[model samples]
Target: MSEEPSARGEVLIVTGMSGAGRTTAANALEDHGWYVVDNLPPQMLRPLLELAGRVGSELPRVAAVVDVRGGDLLAELPATAQQLRDANNLRILFLDASDDALVRRFEQVRRPHPLQSAGTILDGIREERRQLQSIREGSDIVVDTTGLNIHQLASRTAELFEEEGAPRHRTTILSFGFKYGLPADADLVADMRFLPNPFWRDDLRALTGESEAVSNYVLAQEGATEFLDAYVQAVTPIIEGYQRENKSHSTIAIGCTGGKHRSVAMSLALAALLERIPGLRVRVRHRDLGRE
Candidate 1:
């Protein structure tokens, strides 16, 4: 899945909670052929994009790490990002984590959180979360790193930005389990529990949704095909609207009791249907497939 890089420069704003693996993400992007700039001020984003545009494919994909390190200047990022979106391919990837995870990381490193000052690390995290609320909302993707190690985070980052020459409207169909909690980054969600569970079938219990037997069982259900057809129909217009609005990415989460069977099968089926929509790039991922 590769093609010539787009002529127009693509810019990614890498931000979010400090110590949430921003540096690791930047390293992964760099290793995978993205030009990465770290600790970049918010105001420099426009100029950087302009430079990439001038250089064309030589600088086709560039990622900038922008965060609270800029102090008061970080306030201008949203407006600057909006201004760059009209003529450029821009996306924001926010890396976030739970307060406890952040505190642990800070303590392990024997360093104070940037905003901690004389207060506790938790205090700094609370303040940072409040300050970043708006930017996080506007971000195209929010990766919660609460349960991920550096290696896992790096792999996840690669899964997202490594693909080359993606369509104008790209979507990730993620299959997850309800018990593990919902994905923080889901733009839309679909529940698959209404259909029969493949886990109940004695023969299918050992197999995953990737197997033909389970996929057939799930898709052969009474309303499965109809639901897939209608859901794809319902989502087409939204993808078009994203194109019109210069938003390049979206995520649709499909869930069931555990993510191993029904949700995975349905997510694959849905991706197959969506692939026919022309100009839309579809990728499927089972988030909780092997979890216990």
Candidate 2:
């Protein structure tokens, strides 16, 4: 049986750092009924879209996996994608990760980095970053896979692109530890260090923000609600502009000394407030919660 087409045919160009979970994302999209094409060359995008056009609804949501594996030909992707934009509903999704995370993943897989021909894995990664910098900046959605496992990445991908015509805007509220470094994909970042640290409380030290004790402690601090209120008001207009421009995904990072307390509590609270916005989808993730 053929799948029904969406209101308009959609094209998602999935590209990212070599070890940043593109395969996982692709699998998730496929599971959600996207017609996913893997390792497609930049020059082939037009012909692929043309084929989709001829077939109509059979391929309503098409996801093309394009990356640096195309080598120098990758230089042609931005221009090609720009040319096709006027004729199609196109969006680019970029997956990214910290250099440390990418290195760890490469080690775990026991394989050489695709771009790491002679020098160290780090060298290859830096080279790929340089080559992909322009496209990554232009991507409509950027997902950072640094702290996410394959399953989590898959779930995130589904959240961003699943059916029901997709949300007008999907926002991920990510909590992290400043010590673990910033989330590479954050579009907006807010620090919770200004608030009192729940970690300093002996009773709450062992509990995570998900625990009532820790959550209450963090939320009860002065300035907590005020920050959440103002931050929500501040981002509302920016998010609306994103919807106007057809951008569909955004990540707002909340950071504290550690991800286990203040940041986590604030993130959950922020999500609750942001949910009040019309046509917005909110998801909360504690990126560095368990690392400590």
Candidate 3:
């Protein structure tokens, strides 16, 4: 470890296992107003920072996406780490998924892992994990995307890196279905199954939670408003403390038997409540809305 960088722009060193949603993360960072260099070699790391320093406020935050594709050049990261430590300005967001997930992704894309020679995909994944172990251990944040959808992974990326004038922390109020399994990254979960299902009603059956009828029906349940009030009261202080602790990303999974009606309504209602809290950003996603 070294002394933190003083008053310099921040740099995000993004790396990890192959097919672990690095592309999604990089894209999200770019969308978050970061100057992103995709697949940049580690040897250029210092030059990039120097360039950013020269540019000053023009580019206050930069994210470099480094991967196995850099081969020998990737070895320069440890040296770069030493230089960045003092500024306390470097953050490595290590994106990783399970071996099974990586294999599936590689197969789906009809591409072989960069480390794979003549061996199986699993062999390449194993080698990549070994090669990345040291850097991963030293990373500032580790995001496991094994069970997250592309949208969810993108949401995580946004949560991790906040733009200037944006909220310091983000809360993703995700609505999911029990049938599709839980969101692997949700920090907290709420079940809405106790409420009456809109799927059973003829008129609401064809409508989503965003529809006024469905929203009204879902909110009219005996304990619906009470739940939102109670949950907001409970989670508000937790997020305040989270921001105080420098934790940036949080997922609150709200679920029902099916994702379309009750959970979606409740997620919207919850988000409505959370939005009133200062400095806390919220995004609502219906994970299984159309799957039904």
- Relative to the true structure, how large is the alpha-carbon lDDT of every model? 0.88, 0.88, 0.87
Candidate 1 per-residue lDDT, tens place, 24-103, comes to 99987886678999999998887787778778878889999999999998888888888777767889999999999999
User: Each prediction's TM-score against the native?
Assistant: 0.55, 0.55, 0.56
**Best candidate according to TM-score:** 3
The digit string of per-residue lDDT tens for model 2 on 43-70 reads: 8988788778878888899999999889
User: Model 3: per-residue lDDT, tens digit, 186-244?
Assistant: 99999999999999998889999989999999999999999998999999889988766
Error of 2 at 147 (Å): 0.9
Predicted structure with the largest lDDT when compared to the true one: 2
RMSD of each: 13.9, 14.3, 11.7
Residue pairs with backbone overlap in model 1: none
